[model samples]
Target: MFTRLGVGVFIWVAASAAVADPVLQQPIDCTLGETCEIQQFMDHDPEQGEQDFACGAASYDGHKGTDFRINVPDMDKGVAVLAAADGVVAGLRDAMTDRRVVLAEDQTAVAGKECGNGVVLRHGDGWETQYCHMKLGSLVVTKGQKVTAGQKLGEVGLSGKTQFPHLHLSVRKDGVPVDPFAPDRDGQTCAYDAQHTLWAKAFAKGFIYQPGKVIDIGLADRGPDLADVVDGRWSDFVADPNAPLVVYGLAVNGLAGDQMQLVLTGPDGEVVNVTQDRLGKRQAQWFAFAGKRPPQGGWTAGDYDLTVRVLRDGKLLHERKSQVQLTR
Candidate 1:
């Protein structure tokens, strides 16, 4: 596992070139409510990978980095750039025609991964991190400063030859960029890092994220805006026993036989019912299903647990849960 050890502490030492823990890998920041316009993908989203059209050649003669945008719908001013791991900062480049810098070195490195602002910090396990395109002087974390996971190395800004403000975070295992979506080396940076990553660009300056309220989470400018309809969702559960609680949303993720499942269980240690619905494979859809449709004998109404799972190849990639109070 990848743990951001403090300075001077090398926990996992490699014989020659040890690989960092895949599970500890930190992804580019794409948190809830933050919009990330992903110009590329790793191994996980292959279809998306195919759709990703490269505008120009790779690195333009050894520039050593890909370009991306944070065209998140509803965001206009963009978000802040941040560091993915802890390490000694190096490779600070500036004054180029496009105006970009690179901090290359961190423990989490999977192939096909793109971490902007490229801040590489050397640590134990022969690993390093890369944060790309900071806002000129926004990088508060200086070289030689030991940083922890989620530490604000700098704020995301449209600097360093980038069109938007999103961290193009990547990792170097044994001195090479690694994919951020590979499962074999998943979590190569943070042992306790399970939350999904997000990167958003500016859409509209006035829109603010209200947490509980549903927000448009999609990269509209990049073609196919998969809102809750054309997309899928992560939402609260409705436990109104009066009717089979309805769950619906939209998203452009998951494969066939992968519908949203709602797991309902009462206070007692008993499994009442496992709700499963096929989301199908489409850009977007308005989905709505009753947890317990008032069928023949009528559905029982009571407090229960609801777990929404997105399944594919008999695996749950995404899932969410909420409590509901059912009624007769």
Candidate 2:
């Protein structure tokens, strides 16, 4: 069962924690769900309780790295995968082509080639990082080449043994796989061990460990996809007065019994529609939208605001807002 709450005032609370690690910088230009997000984290506790570098179940059994992901459509458009730290290129692979395999079962050709197009870097001391699932033919560095932090290495892609587009970053110490979240280089961290996390304190703190997240938002004549979001497909809207006024959005990490609410407001401050419904069983990712054909004679001109919210057990979980303008 789901309940719809009236449009209330927006409030935000800030929680800050100091970072403990200062060696590595974020290797990508996008933030969580902005241009990219940590799709998966290394699985430290694989036998029973699965935990990510953040000590969350965002990861599954035996996952060996952190997956920084952009939507498939965005990967096709091109998003750079940068070096997280200064290091010398140790190894690389670029033979695999970049193509969406829609399903994990269909990735046999690149089976053992899990890291389809990848690069391994050797930093000072015993630290080594491997960047995986890069776009074919997009490699910008060569073996043995020294690179600085933030240097572009390649683009994220859906090559190898992945069903989506992402860069799998694997960190190792003395050739042993290590969870970056574990400063002690042991294994994994449970939720209660947040203080021992090794992530750049600032970058780690900003990421919300919630189960549901609103990834992208847009206004389109039709439903938009990951590719559409990357291309700025719905950035502009013309008031056809006779056409459909649609606002679409994408979400991930959804669970059963979740509720969604979408509120659309017109330029004249009139409420267009408020779509609310309960979601089905568990879904790793979901796309939800709301729209309707314009009223007779045409539509109103001016600014429009779209607000989306996800709720569980009557508690607000996630909220996103996007503004679009209607023209004459």
Candidate 3:
């Protein structure tokens, strides 16, 4: 159901008659913090500066869309990108090869293929949305077709002007790009209005922006797949007493001068491994791990603990704990 309202040349579909807001669903099929991460948001700043939906520095310069990213190792595993609302396919591009392009080294080759594989959707009331960076051959919908909210559009990919695997979603109203988080990126009104928001009331809660967050953490026998680190294979799972053990975590929204500490404790209350350091510059995401071989007589058959801490200026910012079991 959609309610139409017109204001000059611009218009929007109200999620409900009583609300008068154009509600949108999450444009992906995976759970946040489980299979994906909100890498970057639309630049709330109008002059190509930096700001996010929450008025934070999570976005980069001139970033015009919301970036939902997946781990690089999982890019080939086929994660589906979905439509945010019911709409007709405006157009699409899919012939580009699904390959990584390092922008700093070769900018010329990626001139016309900045968006790589993309699908454009035209909703009622002059609203439009574009999903970019799809896998080369994974586009499932064609031009002029109708798609319901949550319908699969394509798989996320590393194609185009991207250093990571992600889906870049651009939202527009009457041809002008609008920030979905709020009406104006600048000024005194930080409150969200229904007329200015394009997300479902329920979906809006999932987007509470955090400047620094530990997305995932776990223990592993080997290192870890760059894509799928917490494979659920080590959590409470039995491990060989003598096998080398590793504790790792992935973080997002890191700033310059942030410090990180990782510690792994054995069954006998002994510190097996530790890592401490300060990060440099701004970063969208970072990963770290610590590991060591078992003692000469092998680890005791008991529970082990791993803890991760992220701090800035001596203040605790984030902390996460993971565990594993060992057997003789």
Candidate 4:
């Protein structure tokens, strides 16, 4: 199984000889907070709790890698995974099929191959980097071949024990996992220490710590299915003037007590507005929608606007606005 290091103290005692740190570039070819986002980070907690470098619950217990995630639709189009630094290919695996693990049988099938279709690169000075969950048959570099930083390695995939499509980048020194965000800090402390990050200057300057944000929003002719939304089926949806109008929003990392609201406005005036009850507990991913059937004489043509907002403690956390055109 592709298990990670268990919770324990991480003290960086000085070595007799100093090792050069491996400076890293962005591993995925996508804009952060737009086409892709950081789904998770390496856990920094020393005990049984979970804490990301930003002191947020954006990570799970024992997570040893940073996850760069693109939505399913983007995955279908293919997103390239780049080498974080120049190194020799240490090893690779590319025979696994691309599929999500949703059943017990599926989990059993990927027991020892949890990091399906991955590559390991060995940098000098005991530094190494591993890229996991790449698409099968998409690898461009061969084992033992030298690769340059930012070289295209493969496309992201939904293989292994993943529930979503993402590229997991794990950094290591002397076979021990390291958090690129705060590599020198003690495991018990969690905070954004930009000066200690391994990310290249450009990427580090633009990085932002997002605890929760909306991923998708759209207007549909009828209530849209969650699967359809996730698959980008509603990306190009057009509504008929006489059909019902539904506005839906998808968000990630929603905390307990957060409130989601949806407002729809037609050319004529306000059509529907709703504020859902506070969430009972933390949600990794959640969706909220509001809509209404056409009026007595059918809806007015032109443009309809939908606004979605996430609120916590009566303050706005995130907001998205979308518009759809209705034709006769």
For each candidate, give its TM-score against the true structure. 0.38, 0.80, 0.81, 0.89
lDDT, candidate 3, residue 305? 82
Return the top candidate by TM-score: 4
Tens digit per residue, CA lDDT, model 4, 205-305? 78877777777788887778887887788888878778888899888778899888889998999988898999899887889888998888899988888
lDDT of 3 by residue, 1-328 (tens): 1111111132222122224334679887777766787878766565656767666677887776788887655677789999998899988887767666655654455566577788888887757888888998999998889999999999998667776778988777666666676644454554545545667877676555556777667777777765555333344445678777777777777888887677778768855556557787877778787777787998888778878877778787888777776668
State the local distance difference test value for candidate 2.
0.68
List the lowest-lDDT window of 10 residues for candidate 3.
1-10
Candidate 1 local lDDT, 67-157, one digit each (tens): 3334422123335544555456654432222222333432222112223234566655655666665544555666567766556665454
Score residue 83 of candidate 4 by CA lDDT: 93
- Which candidate's lDDT is highest? 4
Q: Give the Cα error of residue 102 in candidate 2, in Å.
A: 2.0
Which runs in model 3 stand beyond 4 Å of their true positions? 1-21, 103-106, 184-186, 189-196, 220-240, 270-275
Candidate 2: regions farther than 4 A off: 1-22, 53-55, 72-77, 103-105, 182-196, 205-208, 223-239, 268-277
Poorly placed runs, candidate 1 (over 4 Å): 1-30, 37-39, 43-78, 94-118, 160-164, 183-328
Clashes of 4: 0
Q: What CA RMSD would you report for each candidate? A: 14.5, 10.1, 6.1, 3.4
Local accuracy by lDDT, each model: 0.38, 0.68, 0.71, 0.82
lDDT for residue 81 in candidate 2, whole number 0-100 = 87
**TM-score quality measure for candidate 2:** 0.80
